[model samples]
Target: MSEVNAEIARFDLLVDAAWPAPGRAEDGGWVYRHAGGVTKRANSVLPLGERADLPEAVDRAERFYAGIGQPCVFSVGMGASPGLDDELGRRGYRLVDPTLVMTSPISGDEAAVGAAVEDRPSERWLRTWWSVDGGRHRDTGEGPARTWGERILGGVPAGYVLLEEGAVGRGVPQGRWLGIYCMAVEPHARRRGLGAAVLRTLLAWGWQCGADSAYLVVTEANGGARALYEREGFAVAGRYHYRVRS
Candidate 1:
């Protein structure tokens, strides 16, 4: 693989570790993940590396998700098995959520204001995040979905930040790389600097904990968020999208 592709593969692994699904199984080089269908990233397949029998692997992935009552989905990252995305497309999978992976070096001097960072997400932190982002995916009413979301958040050791009850974010440090996730600011809090504060706080926490670089994933359509991340020194390092069977 080329150097850029290799780096993208590395980031893919870091992202998987950062936001792990509670239920997972492997079929050849493909990983089938499910978390009660809470999020696509958790429920979809990660078709990384190479498969000796690509068609059989795809068939197995479809069956896995079908058994779990989820639409068969594949996260087609830069490191995904060659032609997997095209094969899925030919099989009538609809492409969704073209996303970008951004990265930046951590300076360790990032300042944290009133935001509070915790080892685990608090009830308030979860509620704040759900309030801002949950509605986008599903209903805000809490139950199994919320439970699954929390489980995913706690799958790995990470720093959770809450800023003035209006913003929240999570940072997982994997060696020298920090994976940032769940960045959300309340609708009413958009104009304020709460989002940046939450990000800086997470970066500072990650750097102090030994991470030298940070990365995050954001949907390409989310220009506002992309702008925020860009202003914070994050640049697009890779791209990926999901293919959902129709």
Candidate 2:
């Protein structure tokens, strides 16, 4: 298949696995809660890959979200798929924050890492992680907002690698068939390979948990981290992103 076709195929597979309208949130470009209690988001504010109609799309999406009492979220990565990242931008959707979509291919010969994934995270790690990522959402206590992270956690499918490292951080797992998100390695231990170590450990765990493959989203690119995943045999499968407004 051509690169474009391959990219589209990959997106289709992900959409089917995680964004099935029949299963949950499927309002067609708006937010739809999944039967699994997971929320599915697509860029309804704009055409897939077309930044031109984004303004109108966001307007329509925002109105839809308000009417439905749900928030609009988009899934973006390095893959070639349809998304509303741009329309959301012109409509005042701020392109902010970072979420990773990573994948780990399964194999018989590939070695499964056995490093211990910390079930108990250190207080310092948790504090620092929350400081960097948690923000006001912890204290907001607003409708839907109160359960921000909680919803994501609660919605995790049955076979996902969802190990929580005590108070430190929650492991968001994503591989070929699964995608990990919001990975935090903590500030004090920044230089060390703890973050990558945790990822490898989780990938290993994901394989053991019966996930055939995995994938996650990464922003632009970090030389060191990108190199590491590449060394571990990961490549950019596709890209998806949308504009966000605060």
Best by lDDT: 1
How well does each candidate superpose onto the true structure, as a TM-score? Answer: 0.95, 0.58
Winning candidate number (TM-score) = 1
In order of listing, the candidates' clash counts read: 0, 45
Pick out the ten consecutive residues of candidate 1 with the lowest summed lDDT: 135-144
Model 1, 46-150: lDDT tens digits are 888877788888988887777766788899898899978888888999999999999999998888774667899888889999997777465333346788888
Residue 118 displacement in candidate 2 (angstroms)? 9.5
RMSD of 1: 1.9
lDDT of model 2 at residue 28?
40
Q: In angstroms, give how far residue 167 of model 1 lies from its true place.
A: 0.7
